[model samples]
Target: MPVHFSLDEYRTRVARTVKAMAAADLDGLLIFAPESQYWLCGYDTFGFAMFQCLVLSGDGDLHLLTRAPDLRQAQQTSTLSDAQIQIWRDLEGVRPADQLQDLLAELGLTGKRLGIETKTPGLTAYNGDMVRDALKTERLVEASDLIAGLRRVKSPAELDCIRRAAALSDDALDAALAATRAGVSEGDILADMQGAVFRGGGDYAGNEFIIGSGEAALLCRYQSGRRVLDPQDQLTLEWSGAWRRYHAAMMRTLVIGKANDIQRRMHDAAVEALEACEAAIKPGAPMGDVFDAHARVFDAHGLTHARLNACGYGMGIAYNPIWVEFPMFYEGNPMIMEPGNAFFLHMILMDSENGLAMCWGHSTILSPTGVERLSKHTLDLVEL
Candidate 1:
């Protein structure tokens, strides 16, 4: 099999997952999250946008139900035997969902307590309703976070992928800095960044590179508007570098010209917040402590109203819409920082009074000794 990790690694992951399954009282788990599948069984595929499910039983049994296009995909990239792979038929009477229910029945899992990832994109509303109605099982429970929590603690191999992606993130940022200038369109800069990402040996990011210039910089969402850069406006960029589906993110704001006093102050506070966050990333620190660090800086600067509620989140093994994993940095979150955990801590501050924004942050990995910054790029408020 062309699995990303060795078969031994895959077995280890399955063992850990089975332990979690036992703890949750899940006799069977119907995994719809693509990342969870890859982590558990090395089932790599972008085909999750369609329909597929990796069934993991507490007894260490594994099975996959997918369509024709992903049948070979699962065969080549996963460690499933031919007998364990079930191809769902989308026939008139036997829909794929019906086939899924049949497969569960064949395995005698229909009557057992089962866990499913209800929030993943791979689990659509139609398929969800279909599966529920087909099985008529009240034992189905929502268990998205159960596996996500396990995946948050990166393995050595996983960290290597993220480290490479982090280097690519620096390259993309450098390309963005090189391509950004007065009169250049945001789309043009974004295109340059994408090219840099691919040319630097990075895969497609989980989400579109968020870019905006002028007052639109306050909006962190991605848009296709062809807004041209101005001499005095600032450009905000929020993006990640993904390698083998693992991600490392960076957020920065670049001014096309000289920065004003308000802009500089905001930038300084954001930078301070980022540094404080890094210092607070040791093992045993609560996730909220990092956000507390971020809040301290903004509140001290009297910009509490201008700051975001969430500073950042874990980033690894993700797909479209976002690269963020669970255990985000927010107020009162008791999720503790542990070794092998990787997260991005961004300080996004928007000064509505001045119609300017200053976003500066980077991702880091918690080590046995201390926290290591994943991105090598300098965290400076660049004036292009």
Candidate 2:
């Protein structure tokens, strides 16, 4: 039987996280957000409206407080056998927060310093205040930084999942690029790409694949429209294949007609920048250094100002879990490239007088010496 993360593994990871929280002087951590809940409990439920909360004590005790109907599903999926499950039915005028307060009191956490996940946007104002009022003796602290720090580095298991996702994404990009032609509509090309992902035993693309032609290609993240490709235009296709809910993205620019001198120049520049970025990826390499490499390539071609962000972030474990983005140009962020970290390297160059050209690739599992390009597509300009 194939197991993703065993119960023992989850318990060990949670123990480590809780020990870190205790070292930071937190008595107990309350994670009400979905990602945090899944991280700690290995229980994933759809919809943000579902009221599910995970509470972990400094002693490594775990508890799940949720609505009554969800209790069975939570128990079935969670790795924590000892997880105390609490169910509540809202009575006249009683909010879900009130139920959480009762659960906290039951756990005898009245006076302990409690840490709350502040990232969940759907937390109600009344619930926030109720938690504070209920735990009258303890101070409420935000644990976003503490949790994010732990989640940024990928584990070996996480890297493996992302590697599979990247492979699937690469296959999808190949199919999409192959299906693209002078007369094909953007919609048809997108359908072909998505179909490839499904046929390859992966789920749908995690995001909308942007299949833009001609002027629309300049829009960077443009969605596929009714526009049909012309022999003289360029088609830029951006998409990813999702496997086990993890996503890996790839983008490429294809010229429909014989490339003009200007188009060829811009494509070469973009490819050079992408290659430079790929070469710069290594453990302990500053993310800024990688960004500067791409920037320098564009500057040498006099298209520095015409570029969007040099590259984009780590992909794996689905940003659905924690939303950790590693932008190349993020100022003062001292995150060095580390082994097991996956990133998307996108090189975008748009010359107003000509057209837009882009090269997107995936790099998963950066090693001590270098990084791995998970994308298997040819980086050279593809002419349809």
Candidate 3:
């Protein structure tokens, strides 16, 4: 198999998952999340857009029920044997859920307590309804975060991928900075940024890069139009690097020709807030503490109205649509800071009064003694 992790590591992950299922008193898991499938057995495929599921019995038996398109995909990328890969035909009037029922029956899991992962894009609400109808059993329960909890703490091998991804993220910023100049189109800058990752043998990120300039800089999400930079403009960007599906994200707001007084002040507040968040990431501390620190710094600067509600979020092996991991840095979040946990800390301030935006962020991996900032780049505001 062309899997990223070793066989032993894969076995260990499966073992951990099965143990969790046992603790929950689950007879099996109807796993639909692509991340869970990849993390469990290295089943790499975007075929989850269709009706595909990986069924894991409590005894550690694995079976993948997917369409013909992903048959070879599972064989080439995952640890599953040919027999373990069950293809559900797309014939007219055939429902995949019925096929899933048959598959479960064959595995002696019929009417057994099954945990379903419902909080992922892999299982659309329509598909979920079909599955629920076919199963027709109250044994199915929501266990969306079961695998996610285990995934937050990165193994050494996973950390290796995250570190490489972080380097690629830094390189992308360098490429963007180098390409930035007056009269440059946002398309050209985006091309340079993504090209840097591809040149470094990196994978596509879980989501599109956020790039905005001038008035659009106040917006945080990616939009369709492209704009050329003015002589004096503000450019806000948020991007991530992916290696073997693991992501390390970063964000920044760059000044093209010169920065105004409000922009400079906002940048200073963002920097101070980001640093305060970093200091708050101590071992055993609540994830909310980091956000608290960010809030305090920004509010103390009298920019509370301009600041984002949340500071940051955990980052890991993510798929398309988003790269945000759970236990997001919001007020009152109780997720603990532990060694091997990777998180992205972003301090974003959008001042509509001045029509300006300032953001500073980077990814970090928590260590036994301290948190290690993944990016090699300095935290100084980039004035290009």
Candidate 4:
């Protein structure tokens, strides 16, 4: 298997998961979140988009039920072998849940208290009902965020991946900035950025690369053909470096020409907010306190209405639709910060009145004493 971590790491993860399972009073854990399953045993595959499930019993059996395409996928990318896999045909009128029921029985999990992640894209409502109906169990607890909570804190091995991923993000940003000249289409600049990522041995980000130019800079997403850049245009880039599903997010803006007074003012405010946020993020600090720092800077500068409600969020193994993890940085979040926890802090100022977008931030990992910026990129606003 092309497992990313040592076998010992997987063993450690499973042991931790077992302890969590016990705390939740779960005899058998039915995991449909690919990240959770992969963390436990290096079982990687996009087959979670369809009907699939991994059964982890307290007795120490990791069983997977999946489609035919992932048969070899699990072998090459995951820890599961053929003996441990149960393939369910996708034939018409044949429910994959039937196969799941059979596997549950094989693992002696019939009617046992099963903890399942009910919120992942992997576990469809139809299939969830199928499994629930087939199991006839006494307790089926919703443990959607159970593994997510455990994974928020990174291990040393995971930190290494985040470090490399952060470097990859910086590389892409460097390339994109170098190519951002007057009269260039945003699409080409975006191509250069993503190309740098792949060439540097990084995987595609869990979400779309948020890049735009000029008026589109105020709008944070990619488009087919943004207006050509001019001498006084602005560009915004917000994307993550993905390595083995771990993400290190970074965001910044580039000005094609000399910035005006308001532009510089907005940029300064954003940078201040970012620094304040970094200072507040550390072990023992409340998660909401980080956002409070951000808000303080913006509110001080009279940009309260221009900022987002949230200043940051957790980042880890994520799939599309978004990359931000749960327990994000919003006002009043009571979750305490912990070491090894990775999160992104971006201060976005969409001053439509000024027709400018100045955003600045990066991903950081909390430490015992303070926070460490993952990327080497400077937080200063880029002026071309």
Candidate number with greatest lDDT: 3
Query: After superposition, which runs of candidate 2 have C-alpha atoms over 4 Å from their true positions?
Result: 1-3, 68-73, 80-83, 88-94, 120-138, 204-206, 222-225, 319-331
As a whole number from 0 to 100, the lDDT of residue 241 in candidate 3 is 91
Model 4 clash pairs? none
**Residue 165 lDDT in model 2?**
76
Provide the lDDT at 257 for model 4.
91
lDDT per residue for candidate 1 within 1-384, as digits (tens), equals: 477788888899899999999999999999999889888878888888877888888788999998888888888888888888888766666667677887888888878999989888888898888878877863899999988989989899999998988988888898999999999988888888888889887889888889988988997888877798987889999988888888999999999999999889999999898999999888988998989999999999999989999999998898876788986899999998899999998899988888999999888999999989987777676998
Say which prediction, candidate 1 or candidate 3, comes out ahead on lDDT: 3
C-alpha lDDT of all candidate models, in order: 0.87, 0.70, 0.93, 0.86
Q: After superposing candidate 1, which stretches have Cα over 4 Å from the reference?
A: none
Clashing pairs in 3: none
lDDT of 2 by residue, 266-380 (tens): 8888888878888877778777877888888888998876776546676654423232243443424467777766777777776666556655455555766677778766777
lDDT of 2 at 12: 69
TM-score against truth, every candidate: 0.96, 0.87, 0.99, 0.96
Q: What's the TM for model 1?
A: 0.96
Off by over 4 Å in 4: none
Candidate 4 lDDT by residue in tens digits, 1-384: 479998888888888888888888888888998878878878777789888888889866789888999888888887777898889997878888877878888888787888889888888888888877877753788988888888988899998888888998999888888899898888788889899989989988888998878888897665666677998889988988888888899888889998888888999999889999999987887999999999999999999978999888997888765777887899999999999999989899898887889988899988787788988777676888
Model 1 CA lDDT for position 301:
98
